[model samples]
Target: MKKFTFKIFAVAITLLLSTSLSLELLAQSAGYEVLFDGGSLEKWRSKSTPSSPIKGWKVEDGMLFMEGEGGGDIITKDKYGDFELVFEFNLTEKANSGIKYFVDTIYNEKSGEMKVNGPEYQIIDDYNYEGVKEDPNGTTSTGAAYLFYPPKNKQLNPHGEWNKGKIVAKGKKVSHWLNGKKLVSYTRGSKDYLKKKTANKFKDDKNYGELKEGHILITDHGDKVFFRNIKIKKL
Candidate 1:
């Protein structure tokens, strides 16, 4: 069946020309709640480079939007173990963005600080990002494990409009979807997820996606990325 989804951060917000759904209300008992309410930032934090937090996100037209460049990583102040996240996103021609969960940002030996390990729900310009130019890296694709798992289809929508995204994280299992298409699914810390990790550049990072609980993060990779209707139902 054809399907589509979006994110409804921890808070609630309404928008013009927006399609409303109860991904949150429907999942109320399931621990579902809004993350972005078009209000001030309370349960959120930002880290532009490494652990250095920056400001670049705001709410507009009922949607949580990342304004003019330079802003860094904006993440939820709270942490979670198991949950379902749904958000709506739209980008510029070559816009780059993504939602990351199960994040355990810690310091590395060699590097002063970094997002040590966490499973990220892939998002990007599929066909228009800078990767399609300069240096081609699978990590920049719309639905790849950011260089681990590569999405087969170019189902990503064109920049300037909205595209639905979903992330399901329960225990050792994780899944990603874009525009209602399955991009990747694997059990966290599982042999399968571990196998792929071992084969990729993340092999050395034992902490990668190993978190049994962590916070949510939104990456402001220097491009325009808008999000809204962010809701999460914790399992």
Candidate 2:
């Protein structure tokens, strides 16, 4: 009788564990996919690589690393029209970089296959990022949207430390987050959105906000910047 009771309890315990695991998996943010896994570039295409193919972007010590100068920006192989992307990034001291989406790549007469006309999530040394002026809004810091919008808080950690970031875009909804706190949100192409874009320097660029779908781009702004845990979900 004791043995039978023990067997029943073991089965119950196993079932409980299985259910708990399932719940945890389900709780994860849906419609998202991993862009990098510290292993291989399964969904990336380099515009700089032609013919023999260019391959220098790689993963090292669990962080994505880029080698040499003029490697060009790494972009998603598949274009995304609407998405919510989340990733972690750490910049070297005095590092400069950015994350841009819905960007159109253009080959100019001088520069070949360069990304143009996209809203950028400005990434830089918060304490040292330049050209910020005191304005009506109190968010003119490093994390601002390069002049259009400003983050509500400056919660980014120190240099060389991992920090969480997120970009959410669906229909007309777009949001930027850092360290689990929402910084700014606005519609992409609504009347108000277009009006604001016109008011800003992006006004002259007709390509601005015209792309309903485009490639996600990680900017290599001529600095040593490290990124990891990059993932995104379709919304």
Candidate 3:
């Protein structure tokens, strides 16, 4: 009788551990998909020419590093309507780059030129950037919503250190996070959003921020920047 009781207890403990492990794995991969896992660009391509091979992006030391001169912006082939994106980036001094979403490709009939337009999450060496240097509070600094909404509380790491970023968009509501801190949150298509859009360069484009579903973009601003751990979860 004693041996049978011990055997039953051991089986129960084993089952419990197995169940817990399964739950943990499920939680980790519930709805998330790894876009770039430091292997290849299977899920990305040059936004300029989606069918052609990527021009200047490279995988180096397990990170997606871009030289920015010849490497144009890369965009995900899949379009996201409402989702959450997370990535890590490290910048060089005086570098300027951005993670742009809600990007819609448009062609101007008059000029016969194609353009990619969206709101940018600014990434730069704020202190060294000449355009934003005068603004001591970092209105256009790292993590700002480009020209539309400036980050009020931003914590940027040193030039070489990695910084975590998150962008969550559901319906018209959007939020930007840097290093686990919420920097900006606003509702798109709202009265304030329209007013702000009209004040920027995007004012000339009617369909700039009105896209319901569009591609995610990593802009190459002629600066050296490294990015990794790019993942997204659709809501």
lDDT (10s digit) by residue, model 2, range 76-173: 87788888888888877767778888877677757655546677787777655453333455334445565567888669887878888889888767
Clashing pairs in 3: none
Per-residue lDDT tens digits for candidate 1, residues 1-235, read 1232233421223532232334434546466777874444555777424335446777666667678766677778778888888888887777777787778667566865555356666676766666645535555577666656665554877888788888888778777888888877767776767777888787898877877788888877777777876777777
Where does candidate 2 have its weakest 10-residue lDDT segment?
Answer: 20-29
Q: After superposition, how far is residue 128 of candidate 3 from its true place, in Å?
A: 2.1
* Alpha-carbon local distance difference test for all models: 0.70, 0.73, 0.83
What is residue 44's positional error in candidate 1, in angstroms?
1.0
Clash counts per candidate, in order, are: 29, 3, 0
The count of backbone overlaps in candidate 2 is 3
Please write out the lDDT profile of model 3 over residues 1-235, one tens digit for every residue. Answer: 9999999999998976565345435545777777876667889988767678898888876589885468788889888989999999998888888999999766678886558977788898886778778765465789988888888677889789999999999988899999999999988889999998888778887777678889999988788888987888898
True-vs-predicted CA distance for residue 36, candidate 3, Å: 0.7
The parts of candidate 2 lying over 4 Å away from their true place are 1-31, 48-56, 107-115, 130-142
Between candidates 2 and 3, which one is better according to TM-score? 3
